[model samples]
Target: MARSQKQKSVTPTPPSQLDRFDEANSARLGLICVQERIPEDYTRWDIEFLVDDRPSRLTCISPGEYGGVPHGLDGDFATILNVMYLEQGAPESGIVHTTAYQMLQRAGFPDSGQYYQSLQESLDRLKAATYTASESWRDHKRQRWTTVKFNIIERITAETQDGLGFGSGTTLKIQLARPVVESIREKYLKPLDMSFVLSLKRSLTRSLYRVLDAHRYQPSMTAEAAAEFRINLQQWARECKLRETVPARIKRNLESAHKELVERGYLTSVEYEGSRADTVIIYTFGDLPATTPAPEPVIEVVPDAPVTDALRRYGVAPTVARNLVSEFGESLVTQRLEKFEAMLKSGYQARKKSALLVDIIRDQGGKYADPEGYQVEPQRSEANLQAATVAKRMEAEEAQLNHRLQEEFRLLDHSEQAARALTQVRMFVGREVSERTLKTLLSAMTSEQVEPYEVYRAVTRAASELRLADFAHELRYAYGD
Candidate 1:
């Protein structure tokens, strides 16, 4: 979905995107908080995340034209968002200038060809990816859990140099989604050092740190209403939002992050729950939470009084003046106004400055189409029948899977048979069943081993698929279209 071409200089961006903000504490806790690794040959990852004690579920979709998980530079995008916040304050929308090299350095990424490629990859993922959450809590209150699904990066502007690569003054214009703006305004987010999150390699330690950091609303495990909880291996995996990796591997990676964080002083200690030998819980959050917070961003301020005076003297409307501040920033606006003064001194009519200035500002910045305006059309190959057929077939398959699992449900011990049955049903079903459907089934199951469900649905997906496929074949044979 990401498109790129060489440009000599950045086109000025429109002001509609000034309000975008980074994923601060308010936004962070609600996310999956872990990388959904791109499988070896696959470009897409269908991931469902649930924190053990949290009531909501976040299903992350890193969908691209060519499917794949987001790269390390995806982490860098968060830093870029914060940079926008710092540069413009709480702007509604506008462009900021800098090269890819500066962004990599700012995010603690190595400056190199590999990283540059990754930067491009990450931007593609961010632009195309979207997440759906059910009653997901945002803000410090954690009480306003509601449904939301949107991209973190609304739009990006990267210019490629002719013989060189990405160079200086490449304007990155971004628009933060509505929910993000509200969270940024409410100050519901915790601040993390971009360097710290980028420091850890892709593994459980990385995810572990995020999970712990997400809990800084209660810096101490003993703090009231903190998200601290007891969990064995399975629950820990779910809570930390790790992908479907082996339990032993997830535990070891967590232990690795544990040791690293403890040595770095982010954790006072990471220990097993004394009463429950298998349970792991955080006992402390080090001085990380108390670090200096970023200064509030000023939204579209006229930083220069002299420029304001000049605009007022020229008879420009106050609202237009404010919008000019937003579009060009105080410094740039001041510069533009000074240019107007120079034009007047050189003999242009004073009365014409405002109209001329307005026209000039509008013409230079390339108009930006709404970022969310694009969507991928659903595929319709022969195998890809209508969604209704797919659903009907799936229902029939699940019905059969249940009936068969129930026949053998009595053989297993009582840890939980339902979970295993659901898992088995997935095995019997084809991959065509959307990940969203699988996520729903997973949410209903407990942390115990997958079991046969307590009961099977009466309708059968196998019969339905057979009937639909046969009907389609018969029609095709009769009308050779």
Candidate 2:
């Protein structure tokens, strides 16, 4: 017998070693609005941001779409910067081969269809919106500050499928605007602790972190120089495109984010000086912890054997079958079979049985649940059937909890909903399983012989676990004990 050689496993770059970057102009000017959502007719014009005690102006124009300017979830623009930096090196004109799924994964978003759709929407907004920097855009090569107009992303093309041009698996060709490319090529860039940024639980906090970091750090700065950052309350609010005007309201709005950053050790303290309209908010930077906190270990959920034994006959991938079992458990077969038999009795037919079965398993909205007329006998023995009753009761309780959460989520305003969703995405990214799976997929994506289907499987499995984890957190928060 001959021994076979084993391929070496690729190690991913640790979060601290990733060395991501942000464009200085965007950071200093706070070009993307921090609010999660804004009115479709919203607009910001000639907002003044101070640099070196000098007033620099910025104007954001959407010319199309909502919020009148780039706002909220548009923070994906920062992820765009990191991706471009990794692929293009010194940013020149070219198309980089990647997928929307990869982008979502890199940004700590769930690799699910809904998030993929959101990513596409954000990309369109970036391409359509224009920014005018007045004595604000930095021309490092010319060593001058100049006025410039540009889009964050120039163009995007994706391979089409089923009349849907952009999707998770679709290949993407994104071109960075020439001005953005020139800015980077000229070295007008700032190093960002991306892991720290993504670790933040709120978009407002992340935005504040970027803006403060820009003002605190200088190319020649020592530790003493970069220790503190201060800004006028009103000016800072305007720079962030805050929807509020009153100083008190602004402080109140920022309080939660301030508390979060402080607790996370990114800031030692956030202080305010003066009163009324003349207040100034001060930020004291804190030393980061020496190491990343290890994620809580994931307790693996083994799929029920009977569920897999039944699903495998439908030609489902083993991993997907496992996921379905983990999600639907003992009821996976009986419920769908009952519904399928009902559909047949009604003279309706599925073109393909396997396709219909898979669809039925995936649909959580009860699309194939017998329409209130049928029930199937349990396929298991009497003893096993009785044992499954507990699982069924737990499932029912989960459904009720989900309903309650959905109502709670619906009561929130648009901004709150967006903020909550963003936090969930970040939380998913911080999970050990998500991190491990992402590293493996990222390594494979860069290889010469990549397997697309395998990547999809990995993404699906990770996403399933992310959904479950997110639900568990929501449950604990909503109902203690």
Question: Which candidate wins on TM-score?
Answer: 2
Position 35, candidate 1: lDDT? 43
Per-residue lDDT of candidate 1, residues 239-292 (tens digit): 454554565566565676677666665566665653333655544655434343
Q: Which parts of model 1 have CA positions greater than 4 angstroms off? A: 1-22, 25-27, 30-37, 40-54, 64-67, 94-97, 137-143, 163-170, 194-207, 218-236, 273-283, 288-481
Model 1 CA lDDT for position 146: 68
TM-score of each: 0.48, 0.55
lDDT to native, each model: 0.48, 0.59
Clashing pairs in 2: none
Q: What value of lDDT does candidate 2 attain over all alpha carbons?
A: 0.59
Supply the TM-score for candidate 1: 0.48
* Cα lDDT, model 2, residue 227: 58
